[model samples]
Structures are given as C-alpha cells and as structure tokens.
Target: MNSIPASRRWMYDRMYTGRRGLKESFVHGVEKFITIACQQQSYVNEGKLRCPCAKCQSTKIDGVHTVRLHLFKYGFMSNYYIWTDHGEEMANVDNNLIGASSIGINATECETSNSMHDMVCDALRQHGAFDILENSNVEEPPNEEAQRFYNLLSEANCPLYEGSSESKLSMCVRLLACKSNWNVPDECVDFITKMLLDVTPVNRCLPKNYYDAKRLVSKLGLSARRIDCCVQGCMLFYDNDYGKNDGALLQCKFCHMPRYHDRNTGSSTKKLVPVKTMFYLPIIPRLQRLFASVQTAGHMCWHYQNRSTSGVLRHPSDGEAWKHFDRVHPDFAADPRNVRLGLCSDGFNPYIQSTTPPYSCWPVIVTPYNLPPEMCMTKPFMFLTCLIPGPRNPKAAIDVYLEPLIDDLKKLWIGVQTYDISKKQNFMMKATLMWTINDFPAYGMLSGWGTQGGITDKRRLYGVGKVTSPLTDVDTLINVSSGRATEESEKIIQLEEQVRKSREEARQSREQNKRLQCQFQSLFNVVLPLLPSDTQHILQQQVDQQSHDNHDDQQPPPTGHYGDDY
Candidate 1:
C-alpha cells in the first residue's frame, strides 16, 4: 500500500468543524479530484473514468460529472490514497492493493453499496451457495435458470440515478404499485412519468414513460401472456400442438364468430385485432420465483415447520380437509416445499362511478397455503393468475377462460425442476390446487349448479310436489279482479279531481288579470287625450310596447320547441 500524502490528508477527513459548526470539505476535494482525473487521457475510456467513491470503489466507470457527484456524496474508498485506478503513480507501490480482499469490506463501503444486493449475497453465502459473486469458485457453474436469475438480480441492483439510494427495480415496482392502487390509466401514468422526468435533475436512469418502466421491470421474469379468446367464450384460440396452425384461425371453431370486429374486406394491411383477450400469468415461473428468493423460500414450509399439535385450529393445516388431503397423498406431503394453492375468482365493475356503459372484469387469484396463515392471506402473497375479459360475466363459460390455468396446474402436479435458494439445491418441486373460494353465484358458475336453491343430489328435489296458482279458486279470482278494478277507479277519480281544481283556479286567475288589464287600459286612454302632442306621442309608444308584451305571453309556445328533446 502507498503512504497517504501529507497535503492530501483532508481526503481521509473529508469533513471539518468550521463557523457553520460542521461543513463538508468533501465537495472541494471531489471537484479537484474530478479535474485531475479528467486530465489523464490514457485512463479515460470513451469519455468515462473509473469512479473511486466508497460505494463503487473503482469498480464502476462513469463520466466526470457523475464521478464528481458520487465522490461528493459517498467520499473516497478506504486506503485509496495512491489513486492508482484513476492513473495515479507512486514509487515502490504494492501491486496487490489494500482493501481488495472480501474480508476487507469496511462498514462505510457496505453502507454506501446497495443494501438489497448485500442482503441477497449474505443470504446466499449462509446456504453455501456459489456463482453469485464473480470471485466464487467456478468448478460447478450454475444451471441456465439460476444464471438467468442472477442476471436479473444484477440488473435490479443498478441504482436509479448516480449517488441515489433507490435501485431501478424498486422504483419501477413502486410506480407500478401506485398505478394499480389508484386504478390509474396507462396514458395517465405515462403523462405523470413525463412530468416526473422534467422535474428531476438527473433523469438518465429514470423511465421515460409507462412502457419504458414496464420493459425495465420485465427483467424480473413475471409477465402476463395475452391469449385471444372467443367473443362468446366458447373456446380459446390456443393450440397445444406446436405443429398445428389452429391458433391462427380467424374465427371460433365452436361459435364460428369472427375473431376480430368487422373491418374493410379489401384491406389486408389492417391489424388483426382480437374481439376478446384473456391475460394468463403463468404459475410455474412465479412458483419457481418463490423458491429462488431466500426470504420467501423458508416461508414456503412454514405450515409444516410450525404445525399446531395442541388441537387448536389456528391455520388451515389443522383443518380436517387438509388432514384428509395429506392422508390421501402421502407422496406429495412428504416434502414441505410442495405447494398447496387455493384459487379464487370474482367479477367486479372497473368503472364504478363512470357514466360509460357498465361491464364486468373477473380476476383469478391464486394463494399458496404452504405459507403461514397471516402471510398466505395477504395481498403480496396473493398472485393474480388470470384476467378474464368481459362486457358480461363469464358465468358457466368461465371454464373456457380457466383452460390455461388448468393446464399449468396439471404440469405443477407432476413436478418441475426448481432451485431453492435457502436449501442451495435443485429439486423436483410439486404443487396442487387444494380448493376454490368464491361467492354463491361464482360458486354455482364454477360447479355447474343453479344459484336459485338448486341441489346437487338427484334424490332430493326442491318444490317437487304439485303446485297450484292462487287464482285457481273462483272466489279468490273474483275478489282479486274486483280489488284491481276498485284501485284503478280510485286513481282515475283522484286524477279527475286534481284536473277540475287546476282548471277552475286557472279560469278565475285569467278573469282577474283580464279585469285589471281593461281597467288600466281605460285609465291610460283617458289620460292620453288630455296630454300635449309631444307627451301623447311618447305615451302612445309605451302603451303599444306593453300590449305587444302581453300578446307574446298569452300566445302558446312553438310546437317543435328545443326543450322537447329531453
């Protein structure tokens, strides 16, 4: 290690007690360092130089402006007195630099580095996991899936901006969560992001819009697949056979309804739009992701690990249904990692207060019961598997929408190779659909039963005995007919009485108004003849204008008035 220079001792103690009580000398040092670093042409690569901040420690390369900002915020790394990484040279300096080993990771550096990344590395290290760190043993390389997950982790660890504590992954997640919680439209979200970009000082890493945000976050591997469905919900335009071209069919096989809305017959350049679409979020990848995370992997076995044996029914594991399932499927229950999932679905109006035409949208949610009761029921644990599109409820036709989910469920039951981060091993993990939750109408639709007091058993039938109408008896029929006639007669009598009173009051008011107008006209005529010629002219004009106004008021309104539209 090179000895620290006497003149540059301020680099070690970047802060000092000044008139302001405590002031940062780090900003001045960062400015001087950046000026010197930028002068080394040989060390600069593509207009960028190595950042020697505490967090980066010469590992990250950035432009001069970003390097200065990072150095000012996090200060220099420990024992970096020589600045060798930034083209600085010293006589007889050791090539094996100080603080290069994993053991030498100091508190300041760790605090400045990405906290989430540190937690992930620590958890993996505890399980004897390898391949995450570049220096880890490469004798046994990670499998394709694990390698992909590590790549995603690296992308997620990237900071949102230079010297920012928040990561790109976390920022994107928060933005998406806000969008969902407030039911904000995609266009609105895009507009808000543009506004955010304008207000922010450093926006290079910030997403430009909603699409950019989604694209960046998609690296996490959780995404929905939009499959075209029949407008009538007869069947999905999905093909299991790779060799078959049935999925490309323009019309439904069962209903023969056109796949797209009517378009110009001669226009081949137009896009083929699906009349209906269902978004299916694959369950296998999500289930694998649960095992991939150290925090959630151990929680997946919480039900088995913390089973209540005191005869208290605190969790679903204590229920008879769970016990029966375990007894019947001993092989599946042998491993605590095997997932038990419960499905739930319901329809809701997306536009609750809108005056636009109403429509129902059904979302199918799946929850893993392997987690503890409290965690399994929470919103974060509840995964939305499918979004069934609807202008109307799917009803019994919901089975068509659930086809993709059912196929995934079947595959999960068989088992898939998954890597468990907590166990640091790969195993064939299995899952099963334990039950379904829904309201009475949804239950009837899912089970193919009538919601109106319908029983499943054929032996027992409701309202099976012979029934007769109340009007079957002649006396009852006569009495009902007489009562209806009497009610109608009373209504008519009351209506006529109201009409007579209104007409009589109107006639009396008209007569009174006519008498008053005649008396006023007679008095005006008598006064008009006694007036001088100039005065008479003005008085005549006033009389004529009053008569015209009265004539207009007495006349009926035009037959085709604008108010008739209502």
Candidate 2:
C-alpha cells in the first residue's frame, strides 16, 4: 500500500464530480479521489489514515494505506465489517458475504492508474489478450458468486501476472452464458479466449482452443449430458438396454434404424442421416434443486394454501375447471402438499426461413401449478421436461420422446422420498399431472382428440355443452314465471308461514303478560298494606308462583319449524 499526499487527494476529489460516466476522469485522478475520500473520514489527518489491514491495525499503524488498498483490491462493496466499534481487524471478521472472495487480488498496482479500464487495458495488451468485448453487447452487473469464483481462479497463480487455465475456463463460461448460441465455431471461440485474457486480471494463461474450454465446462457439471437417439427417433439411449450397457445396440430395436451410418459404405457421409441427439436434463434433480432452497420451496405451496379463492378466475386455481378436477379427484386433492402439473407442448420452426426445407421442433414443457397463481406460469417456475427433436413435426408420435418423462412423472405421482429443505425432514414428495394446456391443433394431437369433426366423449361433451332451445310451451313458461312453486318452493313458503305464526303468537303472549303484570301491581299495592304480616308473606308467595305458571304457559317459539328452514 502506497501513502498518497493530501494535496493529490484534494485535487482528485475536486476533479472527479461523482458522475457515473466520468470513468476516464476518475481513472486519471484515482489516487486523489481515494485520498480525499479517506481524509473526509474522521480518522484521517495530515499524513495518516486509519489502517484496516490485519497486520497494521493489530499494531495501530495509522500511517498505513490499508483502507485505500482494501478498496482497490476488493472493489467497492468490500470491507463490510471494517467500521465496527471494537475496531476488529479484517482477519478477525467472518467473510461470508456473497461476492467476498476467500482470496484477495492485489490491486495496489492499479492505484497508479486513474481509471480501472486503463489499468485492465494496459495488462491486456502486455499479455496479448483476445478481444472478447466484440461478442458481449450487455455487461451484466457484478455478481457475488461469480466475482468470488473469478477471484479464486485469478489468485491461484497470480492470474493478472500469469494467467492460469482455471481463470481462462471461468472466462469461457462467462462468454458462453452471454453468447446467443450454445455451440460456436473454432474461430469464434478463439476470439472469446483472447477477449477474456485481456480483461481477466492475469492475462497470460487461457484455454488453448474451443475444445479445451468445452472440456473444462463439462468437468464442472455445467453442461447437459447428451444422449444419442436412433436416426428414426425411436427412443433415447437412456434406458439400461440402450444407454447403460457396453454392447448396447446402435440400431433402434423396434424401427431397425441405425444410430449412425457406416463410414465404409459407398454412400457419402453427407448423404447419410446423422444420429438424432436428445438432451435429457433430468426433471427430478431440477425439481429437487428448487426444494433445496428455502426461498423457492416456501413458494411451491402457495397455490394450495395462499391463492385467492375470489372465484373470478384470474388464475387457473380460481376457475371452475381446476375446481371441477379437484372435486372429481378428491383422493389426489387430499394432500395440499402434492404438486399439480400442467403439460404444455408446442411445435415451432427453429430456422424461421421460408425458403428452407420445412422442419419443426417440439418442446414439451411442464409447469408446476403449486407456485403462487402470479408466478405459476412464469418461465422460472416452468421446467423444460423433454425435447422432441425433429426434421419434421412429431405430431402424434411425440409420445415416443415422452416415455422417460412419463416414467419419472409416475414415480413422482407415487410419492418419491425427498428431503424437504423448508421442513428439514425426509418425506414422500408426490406430484400429479392435472391437465395439459395447448392450442386446438396440439390438443387434438397430444390428447388423442382428432381435430376433424371429432366429438370427445360425446356423452360428457353433450352434458357440458347442452343448451336448451327456445321453449314452445307458453303454459310451462308462464308457470315458471308465476308463483307456482315446486316442492322446495312450497316447503320454503310453509317455513315462512310458520315463522310469521310464531312471531304473532310471541307478540300476543308478551302483550298479555304485560297487561297481567300491570293488574297484579295495582292489586299488590292496595292489598299489601291491608294484609297481616303472615298473610302478606303467603300472598307474595302465591303471586310469585302465579307469575312462574304464566311464564311457562306462554310457550317457547316452535323449536323446529321456521328455525330449521329459514
């Protein structure tokens, strides 16, 4: 860490107006800016600033430029725990904050440059770094995990000083993620490699070629495993007989289609149809990944417990269709924890060229309806369950690609044993395929409902679609309109009559009782003084008994008549 003069820091602060786009200006005045920022803090004085370095702060080295060095090394968001009341050293604090690297990159050299770009650019040219910037139009904001990973690779061998293979591989992954295409040409890969080397801290070591980059990504489990399929698209080389065995048949057993044409054959390799490729990214693992995180796992049960039931049908759960299915299959609906899924399959032309030969690819997607209604159909919540590759649309034959997925769905339906992260327990995780959502064409193909004049389950269909014609029977219509009542209506009328009668009787009883009370009061007031003490006591007893008998005789309202109906 170099000690910067106060005058330089003041000048840098004055020159840099805190504009985001003034990187060039800031870079030229970087030292001054750091000095000014540090001086403004309460601890900085004429020739000294507070030292946050583990070694210097331990000995209270006020003269050390630990604060500036830390900033330059770790970027802006570093040293979160440096400003504590106890004045703890960097080594003493736990560094679990995201993007905080286990190892630090030395940025003291960069302090000489006015801007970060200038420093990085100088290193790029010296190291013969490729220009990967050409392919990247959007620069993603710095991510903590990515930063940590990048720094880890850089620190392995003083990466900025001497580039390492690990650092190059990290750069490769970043390029691939940003690139539109999954597969790129050799020349393109070379260009990306050069660009990464230039920008990466250690600009020397990078992948020799595209193959090397791919090999590294595969080893890291970041690439999907590809399974070869029969040229006729019979089945994926995934099952035990096809994929697992050493002497697995290359030809489709059912269709007798060769997986690959023999090179020795008189036919040109270009004339030979290539083996179909199927990328089967297992859904169970993907789903399990969702449950492994507390944030998403909590949301998985939103539909069952938290979805609105306003009956306006803003979401699928609020509609009659979802409720009908649930009502019909009470056993499946018994557990709110069980996931309900909707299968959506559609075919689209990938090339999007009218002049080219017609070809379409069908992607089978599964969406968990268990997420909150708002997020249920969202891209993040939906999983690409299967891909039916094609030079032609699979149409009805799409079921062939669905076999593996179906088997998995069956296992999930039967309740596979899974660890629930939210509950922190091992439990049977059940999922049900509730419905398939698709366009009219896809619905017919996927659901065996023929598109041409086909009535699906005519009896049920008629029941669902039944519409009454205009009534010719005026008398019946008039009866419906008039007060002519059915058994239910007559019963309701009878109940109403009973309620009225009850009310009338109660009202009459109350009036009679009040009149009797008035008469009794008049008699008691006049007779009380005339009676002897013994006689008065006897008379009071008689009056109390009479009142009790009258109250009992009034009768409680008929218990079962209107009360039960109304």
Candidate 3:
C-alpha cells in the first residue's frame, strides 16, 4: 500500500454539486484505502477498524462498514495520508517525493511538525484538556486558566530546532524522567544540558539548565509547596495569618524552640534559614487532575461501577466499611466521580547502607480507592502528599505535621468543582478519607493510642516507674478496691473455672491410660506362658517394639527431618 501525501489536492478537494454525493474518484479512493487498511492488519478481521475520519480522528474504534461511512460523511483526517496507525511505515515513504509535492516545506519539517502536534494532542487528550484546543463553540475568549493551559500546550508543540522532532516540553520531560530514574544530580543535568545547547544549532529552543527545565514543567499544575516547620514538630508557619509577616515567626509557640538555626556572629548578612522544612503537595488539584483524562475519569468510577454483587470481599468496595460509608453519605456516593482515599505514612532511612548519622524521613502517601484493585495501589496512582523531614521520629507530635493535610481533607469533604472528562461536564467532586495505613508505633503516634501496654485495652495508660499487675484489668482493680464483683472480675473468675475443669479432665484421661496399660501387661504375661515357644518369642518381640515406639513418642521431636539413621 502506498501513502498519498497531503499535497494531493484531489483527495481532499470537493468536486461535486449539492444533489450528487462525493465524486466517484473520491469514493474509489476511499474504497481502495479501506481495502489496503484491512489487508495490512489482522485485527481488522474482528469486524472493526480505527476510523480516521476528521471527527473520529483515529481515537474511536468502529466497525469497518461504519468507518467507511464516516469517511464518506466527513472525509479522512488532514495529513493522515501516511496511515501509520494502521500499518504503513513512515520509513517506507520517499522524503524527496513528499518534499516535492508539499511546496517549500521539506519532508523532515513536515514529519517533525506532525510528530510534535500528535504528541501534544495525545497528552492533552489524556489530561482531558483536549477540548480546550478542539472546541470551537466559545463566543468569548478563554479565561486566565484556560489561556495559561493553551500557552503551555503551544510551548509543548514548539520544536527544539528547525527540523528537530524534539519539542521544548518533550525535551524537558525526557530530561526530568532521566534524572529521576537514574538519580542524576542537578549539577550533572545542568552541565549536560548546557553542553547539548552549545553543540546544537544556535536557534535551539531547549532549556538552558536543569532548573530551567524544571520551571517549564512545573507550569503543568503539579508543583509542590514548601512550608517551614518547627524543629520539634510543634507547628507549621503557614496559613494567611503568617502571610502578612511572611512567616517571620522566631520560635515555636508550644515549645519555645527557635525556628531557625543560630546565625554566625561574624556573618551578619547571612540569610535566616528555617531549621526544618516540609514539602506539601495539595490533594485537591491532584484529585481534579485524575478526572481530566477520559481513561482515568472512567477508572475513577470503577469502585462503584464494578461493585461486586456476589457478597465476596474482592475489593475494598465489597467490604462493609465502604457500604456503611455510602449509607452515611448518600450524596457523595451518588456521584461515582467523588473520590474515596486511604492515607498511608511511614518513616524510613533514605540514605540506606550509608555511614552517615541515623536519620528518618516520613512520606505521607494518599491512595484513591476509586480505581480498580490492580491500579489503586500502583506507584503512579499513589500521590505523595507530604515529605516530613526528620533527624528523629516525630513520635506523638506527628499530628502537628499533618495539619496541612487535614485542612485539605476538610476542604475536599466540603466539595470542589471538577471537570469530568468522560462525562464532558463539570460537577461537584467531594472526597472522604476512608482509613489510614500505618505500623503499630506509627499508629500510636497518629491516633494517640498507648501501644506500649495493655494489649486488650488500648486506652490504658502506663508510665515509667508505675507499678501495675499484668494480669489485672483496670476495671478489675477498681472493682476489687470497691469490694464489688464487676463484669471484668466475673469474666476472669469464669476463665479460671474453665481452666480448672480442663486440667481435671486431662488428669482423668492420664489415669485411665495408665490403668489400661497395666491391664494389657498382665494379660500379655498370662497369655505368654500358654503360647508355644516360637509364638511366645514373636509375641515378646512385638510387645518390646510397641514399648519402644511409645517411649519415642513421649520424647521431644528431632531438630532435623533427615537424621543420620535415615
């Protein structure tokens, strides 16, 4: 199959009057196109093919006949003459032929433009922001937010150089991905990017350094906010109250700890840097972003849409906790797009296997349970909400660090206006924190539970140098002091009685076994004398073997299965 270049005017030009439909030549061209597409891919035999009509734009999969009808109605998408999505390879086409057909523009330039355009469109489509570029019904100009998004999209489409396939946004994104995957240092990335720019064409559009690349990418609306925190984790210097003074508080209100390190006596011009700081990634914008893409927007409803009916606990949605939540908040549950989240936080040594001093950093991760089981816990979906810097565990003071996250949760509970890309409409999207994930000590820190003592009762407090009986419950002690038989004391008495009964039964069984053994020995001695010499010898051997087996069973088990005898 041959690719018809976009410069072939007859393929796209309308050549018919109102009464008659498309010209016979165009119809013949469509028929030949369909025949070649079907012949190139085996999947088209399954009764469907990717429609390349301008309306569908190869995004919609439809029956072969329907695709043909769409082409007849709307014509093929512009510059889709390559048919790369179906089977035609761009490498097979002659660059000189494409260049000659398309006026002054050469094949490389055209290909680069197409590639950048497709890349930008695909990204916007996934983010559910494609409508901003595609929609033509707006009478008024785009708002500030929409206009900003459009500018970013334009930058993403701008090529790095005149014939280069890489765009400014693409280069920045690839560089960032490489930096993250390889743990590359900022200085190294700056050096490499600088070297590339120096060697490349003078008209290059690439970012100057690592920071420049990061700045360009940060405009995508997923940037983190850094907030100074107290060294003792007492409070954060955030919110509007601190805005006027620019968070210039000198010390923590609770602990009276200095907010910043002591300044050098000689260096009076040194900046006052915070003793500790945490990075907080707001949850609302992230949750809204999830519903922007059609793929993820549909998935965000999987918990409700794919709710199990067989009464099996396959997913969190199948559990009673989720159902009870729905019963309590019907309004939130009514909208499948409303998110349900699980928060998880843990402290780990970031500098593993190092000789450096011991340090712990806590990362608070938020997972949306709206996705299916397979996707809900994946790294991509696990949103890192905060990074708590530490030289030691926050312990009970962890709540002080969680204040910002709690504020975000409260706002989410009230609801936020979000665009649902799958539905193509705006709706109030609310979210609730269903539960928390943490280890025992972390749980104690988060919930104020005394995990160090009282296994059955979490509320019981035990302090240093305090004397208490391990077996006595708080209620039992109080009842004993009052000389009253309380429920706890009665329960303890019942347990003791049950233990006594079990011991008595065990003793009776042991006595019965001894009596039976003695009777068997007496009977064996009586029968031994009446037996013949050979029969007596065999009977004695059997009795001896049985005794030996019984002795072995009473002894401790061997440490290993494969012993020297075996």
Clashing pairs in 1: none
C-alpha lDDT (0 to 100) for residue 13 of candidate 1: 71
Q: In terms of TM-score, which candidate is strongest?
A: 3
The runs of at least 3 residues in candidate 2 whose Cα sits more than 4 Å from the true structure, single-residue gaps closed, are 1-173, 181-186, 198-225, 233-237, 240-247, 265-274, 320-337, 454-566
CA lDDT, candidate 1, residue 3: 35
lDDT of all predictions: 0.66, 0.51, 0.66
Ten-residue stretch with the least lDDT total in model 3: 473-482
Q: Any runs in candidate 1 off by more than 4 Å, and if so which?
A: 1-142, 183-203, 241-245, 265-269, 354-358, 449-566
User: Candidate 2 residues 228-328, lDDT tens each?
Assistant: 67766666656642234512566777788887756775655565444787665566656654554333455566556545655565566665556665666
lDDT of predicted model 3: 0.66
How many steric overlaps are in each model, in order? 0, 11, 0
C-alpha TM-scores of all predictions: 0.56, 0.48, 0.59
